[model samples]
Target chain A: MWRDHLTEIIVFSALFLLVSAMGFVAARWRAPKDMAHLDEWGLGGRNFGGWITWFLVGGDLYTAYTFVAVPALMFGAGAAGFFAVPYTIVIYPMVFLVLCRLWSVSHRHGFVTPADFVRRRFDSPVLALLIAITGIVATMPYIALQLVGIEAVLKTMGVTGESALARHLPIIIAFAILAAYTYQSGLRAPALIAFVKDSLIYIVILVAVLYLPYKLGGWGSIFDAADAKFAASANPNDGVLLNANNQLQYVTLAFGSALALFLYPHSITGVLASRNRDVIKRNMSALPAYSLLLGLIALLGFMAIAAGVKPLPGAKEGSVDSNTVVPVLFDQQFPDWFAGVAYAAIGIGALVPAAIMSIAAANLFTRNIYKEYLKRDASPAQEANVSKITSLVVKVGAVACIVFLDPQFSIDLQLIGGVIILQTLPAVALGLYTRWFHRGALIAGWAAGMGLGMWMLYQIPNAATGRKHFGGSAFPLADFGFDTKKTIYVGIVAVLVNLAVAALVTLALRAGKVPDGVDGTEPDDYFVDESDPRVTPGPERDADSAREPVA
Target chain B: MTAPDPEAPEAPTAARSRAKDRSPWNWLLFIPIVVPLIPAFFNGDSPRLFGFPRFYWLQLAWILLGVTTTTVVYQMTKKKRGGGR
Candidate 1:
């Protein structure tokens, strides 16, 4: 038993040690003489161009969350979980259209995060604060979702074998390493490690999707196996594709996820760090290629059924923890050493995004909330220091997510998070195009939408975990007792509500002679190139950084 | 180090220079990717349509498809995008 897991522990631990050693030395990877400014610490010298940004963003977005949860969902409930594939496929076109605009505007102003863009675009620090807070709030559970992937892998290896300490020890040790290096190196460590993380993942997914089916049976036999079991399955809850109740979930989940995908500050941070608009444009078109891979990866869920891969005991017999399905599929079916490779891919996958999320969260507190409220005159070096320290704290919150919350619940929280982050779409995405809505109305709209989204999610419950938090619930079938099964994305519904409220209030405020915040951007700035001298680094204006280096 | 300007008047010239370096194989990569997609959209279950069962043939055709698509994209693109380089 230990042999199965031992190889994994050795390989993973050694790799982590090696990565951390590299991380401690990473400040010297391309160490700037004095690494005190935001440029050096926060954005990895703000010099990642087309290829580097490609690998970094690709690695960051399609993470351990996609790896473990997609298959687990497929394993548990059949086709309902495969929405991740199409969502990913569709996401490219979506981002391909929007990301370049963001890149241009961000480059023009030297915005480090989306909130930074909002503050500059609208000339409203309050609006940027709302966006920043939304980003941090939405991103917390996402970092936790990465840990769930590691835990699922650990649980499969039997390292967690009946001991609570065993179950959690790996997570804590790994996060400790993560927090340490992230504190020391900022984005460079993850950016560097992303190369190895992505290579291993491509190898694992390419091989497993190809090899596993061949080993079990051909695709024919595999799907035959899946069809046989699902048809005869004991769980009445099971279906090959989504039913009426689950249909809303599929659409809403996909749509909400698309909106949320770019909205998350971590995702935007990755985009903003690109060296040019063309890089963003190229990556947007290119990133969807992962969707092809994702579709194949999602097949692992159905493949699990075909292989007659059963979930472990303690969870429902039919409903295996969707989180464990991918790890179990690899561990059980692949060779021991190779499974170690697979485990490493997943383990490393967790780190890059966690680092980015922590960075994004810490930047928010330091820039928008702290600098805006607490210390207006903090130095670049001081703000960078605060962001670094706060990054460690953000990681602790992610760790708590794994230690306490159910893995399945984290998935749902991510979904709810999508809804939460989407409320800022108008103030953020739409505001990129126009600042027509008043800042007060936008804030009011955000509060109303967020409140209503949470309320709706809270009222609905999943039969699986049976809790009443943001994660376990879905949008109810018929609001106000309407009979339409035609449901909506919670995020979309929230944003619509947000937009309506903002417009109404904007009209009301205008009628009442109230003042709206001043706009700070010029028309050409939206189309500005990376060489525009006016780009202010961070939020401050100084000779060293007309744009805040950290921003 | 270059004056921290966001606008580059030189960008248009750079983009034009890049267009010349674009890979000839870029369109070729799509062939492999799109070929199998065709069968997936159509019925592979028509045994009369092919030698192997649709299910049996789906991914084998796809491995070729992936390799072809990757190769074509690799051949055509000006720079390595998805880690091949």
Candidate 2:
């Protein structure tokens, strides 16, 4: 078993080296003279054209967790896991209209984070601070999910042991490589590396999808076996597209996840990095193709079950951890060299998102919270420095998540993030059009939404451990005496409360004669294109323009 | 003919009026609006939808049909969101 994982070790090292080497050279790919600006460090010089933006955002949106977890959920719960497919398919066109406008306004105004939009659009720093804090807090568990993805791959390769120190060394080394480049090269690294990451992921997934099915019977046999297995189960509602008990959870998770996808700081980081409105628009139209890929990947769960693919050497029998299902399938079915390629796909996938997310969160801290409150006159170099340090600290926190926290709990934190960030939707998403809601009311609305969402989330109970921070098992509807055993997304319920409060408070505040915050933008900003002079601003000062790329 | 440079002078009308000829039927995007209810409206165990079981095909079928529903709804909200289709 010790020697078994050597192939994964070598595969992982090669991928790390490749992404890192590309990261070192990325400053030249776009070749920004000034590394001091947030645009360069945090958003990859804000010059990514449509094709680069497509691959970068595509890699950013779909992560190692997605590749592992979607299939894992399918393996455990029959068809219920397939909700990811419909949610992703629907998310793009749903947001396509809104995001282009956001891109337009942000580019025109020099906004680095979504909170910048909230601050200006609502004309309230309180609203901006709330959104910034929500973005950072929500991103923590999403980063943790990447660690979970890495851990699952590690376990599949037979790398875990009773020795805790030895078990986590792979992640420690991977994150170290991740932290070094992010600290040195910033967003450019992830931008360059995403091309390699997406290429490897697509290749691995395509091979496994077609090759695995052929080796273990065919599509017809696989579906029949999955249906039979789920049919004999005790839940009784487990085998179809939509089951009665899980239907609400499915629909809400789908809609709620779609809303949350673009709201995550990393998502905004990806879009804001694009060169122009057309890049954002064209990419959204093409991005849904990933969902088509997602549908097949979710079906990998059923395929695993059909092939009678067992868990890794470490896991208990019949109690195969669903997260390891994909890893084991590749390990069992493919040759050692090919398994190495699949392992690298998952590894590089984790690295790209982890870097992008940390950078997104740090940019929020530096721009909205730090500069707005503590260091008002901080120059572009100082701002970039603050972002770099915060990125390192956030990576440390993500490592802590993998070492100590339950992976499922990390998923719950992500759900809570969706709920929290959706509060910004009314202000950020709706604010893209008009400023009908007063700034003070928007703050109150944010407070109400966050409070209501957290209270609902806290009431959820996880039966496995009887602990409750956040998760589906603890959904408050069951405890409220209305007792319908249905689970709905806390974020959806919370966002509704937020919108209602914002509307009501807006009417009240408009009557109370409250002054709204400043608005120095025009609608023309939304239609601004690549050649616009406003995009260039001025030369940002930095000391390291002449430093050699770290080799 | 000139290429009508996207960066050329913007006529104010072109900038703000992606919503110009607003038809009353534009609101019909909200129609199926409620029609996802038809399958659940029929409410059956083995009800036939065309040749296939309503249970198996309804949710899957709605996926394709839902895109049409979304495009039409977006046409109005597109104006509301301040842009073109």
**Candidate 2 lDDT tens digits, A1-551:** 75877876687668768887887777677677778778789988877888888888888888889999988777767656766755765676667657877877777667789998887676677888988998999999989889888888888777776766778888888898888888888888888898898888788878876787788776666776777778877765467445555667766767777887898889999998888766775675577667666766777788888878775542333444678888888887888878888888888899899999999999999999889999877887898999999999999999888777656668888768778878888888888878888888788888898999888887776543346555452253666677587666777888888888989999999999888866655555565555554444324212322231110
CAPRI-style grade of the A/B interface in model 1: incorrect
* Model 2 misplaced stretches (Cα beyond 4 Å): A312-320, A463-469, A473-485, A533-551, B1-85
The residue-by-residue lDDT of candidate 1 on A1-551, one tens digit each, is 66658887687677767766766776777677667766567888766877778778988888887887777776766656666754554455445436767877766655668887788766678888889888988888889988887877777877764555566887998999989988888888888888878888889889987787778767767666665766786655455544545656665666567767888888888888777666776675566666666667777887877766766543334554657777777878888778888888888889888888888888888888888888988887897899999999988888877676655566777767888998988888888788788888888999999998888877766666555555343565587587865455567677788899999998998888888755666555565545544554433335634434333
Interface RMSD of each: 8.6, 7.6
Determine which window of 10 residues in candidate 1 chain B has minimal summed lDDT: B48-57
DockQ of 1: 0.07
**Chain A TM-scores, all candidates?**
0.92, 0.93
**Residue B54 C-alpha lDDT in model 1:** 42
The candidate that achieves the highest TM-score relative to the unseen native structure = 2
Per-residue lDDT of A147 in model 2: 89
**Alpha-carbon deviation at A229 in model 2, angstroms:** 2.1
Q: Chain A TM-score of model 1 versus the true structure?
A: 0.92
List where candidate 1 sits over 4 angstroms from the true fold. A1-4, A161-163, A234-238, A242-249, A313-320, A404-409, A468-474, A535-541, A544-551, B1-85
For model 2, state the Cα shift of residue A268 in Å.
0.8
